[model samples]
Target: MEIYRDSKLILEINDKDVNLQVFNEKISMPEFNNVCKLNPRVKITDFIALKKLLNLDSTEKTKIGELKEIYELDISKDEMVAYLKIYLTNSEIDRDVDKVKTDIISFLNSKNILEGINHELLNSDIPSCKKFVVATGKAPISGENAKLVYYKLSERKVKEGTDGNMDFYDVKLIDNVEKDDWIGEKIPPTLGINGKTLFGKIVEPKPGKDAQLKYEKKSVYENPENGNYVLRAKFAGAVKFDGKKIGVDNHLVIHGDVDYSTGNVDFDGYVTIKGTVADLFSVEATKDITIEGKMGIGAVKFIKSRDGSVSISGGVNGKNTTKISAKRDVYLKYVNETSVVAGGDIHISQYSMDSYLEGKKIILSPKNGRIIGGQVKADHKIITGSIGNKFEKKTVVNVKGFERVMIKHELDSIEIILKETIGKANKLKRQLEIFESNKSRLEEKALNTFRALIINYDNIMDEIARTNIKLDHLEDMLKTRGDGEIKIVNGVYPKTVLEIKNLQRKVNDLMSCSFYVKDNELHLYD
Candidate 1:
């Protein structure tokens, strides 16, 4: 059987015999014959025959020696890597590097390692008697997971002062969006590319995992233009995180102090100020308002909520400088010289010192809450831990039968205005009467002035009629009465005036009692 063949010689191995035939007598043929004799697998028994054949261009096969073993080829268990080892001596394997490479390729083909052959390394010099990594397998690429890509809103940059310094407080912390504005989109996962091994075995890749976009349907909706993965705002407002979902809220938030940086916030939504409001500034909102920081004297001209409530965690140190109003309720840590009016209730956690508080009900914390040296009025009831201090600060508490006093005061004021309107109308009528008497004898300009006077008279009469209707409505409200009370838990010291409805009780002695109206008179229950 033929073991190896080349252009110049043919090497054969028979039963216990090695043969070599040199068909061409070229300059390198003798060298090739010598290399063939040097193969350790074949021990030369007739070196003279091989030399005679190389010298004589003989094509006839001749026996030279017997065989031992062949070169070794190793493949990894996974068949991902392959290595070849030439076990012959260095001098025996010394030949043209190209021919060696050809022999290696032939061996690899026989061993079934046809893929990923390292041709570059094979093209260079290879060592003998040492394992050489001749092939490598390709690795599969993993797919990327799904992700969300948010659209860019405003840059959170601050304004530069005249000296070129950045105004840190002016940086925008909230992202605002208009109705139908795109917010973000989910990017789908991808399928990865496959790979192969040294044995040409196929490798499957891992597909990426998909994800859903989190959002609220009320404030955010899927954009029809880009399918369900894309999101858009449903209203014009601030963008915020509603729990775990991203949403657009009808609420404005001030992350820092509300000063020149955020000019007097006047939003038509819920407002939350994490910091203090500066002096002379005002905050007005259509919904609830919350102030996390303290309100100093003159800090704000007014903090008002048109249709919701107000809560101040750090209390008010207004010093009679700010007016706070809410349609529903007002919650405060403490009140110091501030005037607050709420249509629902005023809840104070601590002392209310020299502050004018008016609400449907005034509630102070029963633990240590106190009211000292201020007018407190509630339409329903007033509950406090203490009423007056030891020094007799003369605090006044009024529970006036479900806004009866408030309605009476409004009615009185409107009656006074009505009286003025009637008087103005009578005066205008007398002036018009004098003009009508002289109109026939007056010139064109005089007649025009007379006509204007008559119209003014009619307008004043209409004003009087409207004022009378408003007064009548307030008077009717005063007639619709309800129960009212004032309860003092700890003590009502001397000089404290407690009133219920039209009755009054002066507490000259320290007493803890509930004052209510009974039998058309004020009664105290201890």
Candidate 2:
């Protein structure tokens, strides 16, 4: 079967003695029927492997010289495998492949591999280079101290010398991607001094540049495949796009939508997002801030609050030299890892260690809260968690270890079982049992009722802690009451004093605890 340059399909045939793989790459075909052109010694298996290794599918654009300019490159098999990787993978590979490819190009340019190779390539507008060794890591290792093998790819020739002895490979390179299809095309073996070696050409910058630098601009280039604008220059200022005369730190405006979905919402003014502020419309306001909604993922800021204290309340997004401030006593109730100059005290309820905080004094209420300044300096208390971070009655509380339990869980915080509620239930049950039990040995159901009352005592304490009910005369009732209880009728019946002095005015603190300790060894059961 004869291979044509028109298609991507590879046909293999075997009639009697001869077996062949017909590759559609025209440059790889023989120059004559009688004389072997180049690397005729290379096995057909290796050619098929190289094609597969390059990851060239039948549909990945096989036509050349139309959308892409055609090229007939000459290189060695080893170097070809290394260079072809760029187009084969979606992103850049490791540094070793780049280094090897660079060496081949350098060698060709210097004309050290084969004399007139560089001249011929240059005359054809194909800039080639010769590989050379440069020292890194202070100095080269001494000859007597190092021994390594240096092998040639063109010839299976291994040369021995001091530790630093080395020679380089050569390659023919074509620049100008649109005009040169050589970038993605596989070259024949004749590019090297010895015809047995094959190398692949890539559409890229010069040798040193390809190995060291990366291509990453917003408007500099247009990817024919991706159809997106590559950055031409580094960004200098913020650009908020909502069609308003936004405060730009720089100039030259474009479409600015407040969503990280495309890029980032770059702004230098007060960002007022009418939408959910889904991106938090992160801004660097030399003044203060006010987001009607919550901050989206990865949103950061250096904002000033209405409160004198500069508070952080979102993920770090844009860099702001301006101090972060709040309106009232800035409540870090919902602050995250965003930094702030914090001219005033910083209230940190829960912040990430990755967050940087600088303030007159940081009031941390997070678990195991850490400080990174040379010295921890706080004038007031450094509450790690809530003094009673909860809500009871109508008052909110900050409680120790309150961070462990969630208070805002869907409808759970509202449905609380207070100590008074439990006591009322217990009293009703006990009265029912006394009037209802009809046996000497208490019925199992009655026993179960009593057990449930006992079981709920611990929960009662948890409710008290959760409610933070600081009843003014509660101690008096529990401690200094009359023989039974004088506050209400049939006080032993355990009815809640709903109208006690200053009740329902205390804060809430939800922490679970039960048996009151009488001594080192309490007169208590479990």
Candidate 3:
């Protein structure tokens, strides 16, 4: 037993087979088989305890059957890490732990798994019999991108009143900014971190991209501090952000009423009035005009930009003396006893009383959009909730273009003139014929009258011919004009006149209908 304990068996693993060296001590085959069972890759099919039973005296190296090499070391495609797996086979040889460890380390070094090695897992008991995770790799963390934080603007509309008025105080009419006010800030991008793989390969992360700040001239300034950018206003005015650029327009602000003391204001940029535009006062702007208070009697307001639109938060009480014109669209809370002309569309939120409005299109509010006691002319369509009052004070709605109306009027005038001229020409022709027939029986004065009558008749005939030609041309033009329509959502009162092109219809009773031109006549449809 001492000899058996003092002697050791040498094991070697090669590419094809495992070999063992037996010392000159009595060896128990059962003990060797038990040790072989520790390696999953080694198994014994037949065991004869020859050394213990026969007491063998020879000490020689013997060859064991092939180890089968069923398992392999797996390396990831990214060369990040490595793993080892072992499989059972028919062999009776105890595996050498030191030799297996050296082989695993050599394989990992060949695949470049130089970092994050799990040595304890590699040296664990019966490591070859189980799957072993030998290495792990780190992944890089990317940095955040830059962003723009803008100061948002207010988005509130005018509030409606119970007394058929609009509350202008609820609307945010201006986004005023003082000089050196912070408009926006640029959140800078952070630097990226470097990373490494289990194969000792260096990974470079992509750095965050930078963006520049854009601003209008004399409106904003860019400030850079500690790798961060900020945008500040340069002058006191109305600030606006147009997606890519920030701008400020000089605004003329009137704190008090636009009365005789304020006179008339004509600005090239934006205008904001805190109080009412009193009677007979005029306000004009090349860009936008905002009135915080109500529009008084006889006030005049105009916006010149063909592309710019106007928004009137409060109502207008024109008292038959006010006039408003915009080259583009006009949005109003309410209008009373005024004349309005817009090159584009007109949107009236509330009621329009005794007002004359003309535009490409006229649209009234969905609720309480009433038009009473005046005329509305639109080139395309006139949409309203109600037209005319209960008493029927003669409201007129013309859906034809103004140019067509003027042309039709001209044609009528020409026809009247042509009738008068033709009648005069016929009378002169008869008189001249009578004078020629009695030429021999007339005195010197009568002969002179006959000669003068002949010339006068010829002149009248020429004039008649020219006038007839002009009338024909105007009639052709009237035939070529396009048609327009009027749509009343609620009702049209009696005595309300609806006209399209040259056709006109007078409402004798309340009717909710749509009026359009068909076959040169105004037709009403449900």
* TM agreement with the true structure for every prediction: 0.42, 0.19, 0.59
By TM-score, the better pick of 1 and 2 is 1
lDDT of 2 by residue, 1-526 (tens): 3222224333222332123322444323333221121112112333444344234333332212111111123334333211111111112223244553565456444532332233232223222222212211111122221111111112212232243221111110101122111111111111112221222223232111000011223312222333222222233333221111111223212233345653334343333332322334433333233332334224432344332222223333333222234432333433333454454445543432323444433454333232221122222123233222122212111111111123224123433445456666567545544533333577788778756654464355445544443231232223421111111111111111111111111212333211121222211111
Identify the runs in model 1 with alpha carbons over 4 angstroms from their true place. 1-249, 294-298, 402-482
- How does model 1 score by TM-score? 0.42
Kindly list the per-residue Cα lDDT of model 3 for residues 193-220, writing each as its tens digit: 8677887777776665444455675788
Which lDDT tens digits does candidate 1 get at residues 224-275?
3533378889987777652235777697878888899989889977787888
| Residue 506 C-alpha lDDT in model 3 | 89
Poorest 10 consecutive residues by lDDT, candidate 1 = 164-173
Displacement of residue 195 (Cα, Å) in model 3 is 2.6
What CA root-mean-square deviation does each model show from the true structure?
Answer: 28.1, 33.8, 27.1
Candidate 2 — worst ten consecutive residues by lDDT sum? 167-176
Per-candidate Cα lDDT values, in order, are: 0.75, 0.29, 0.69
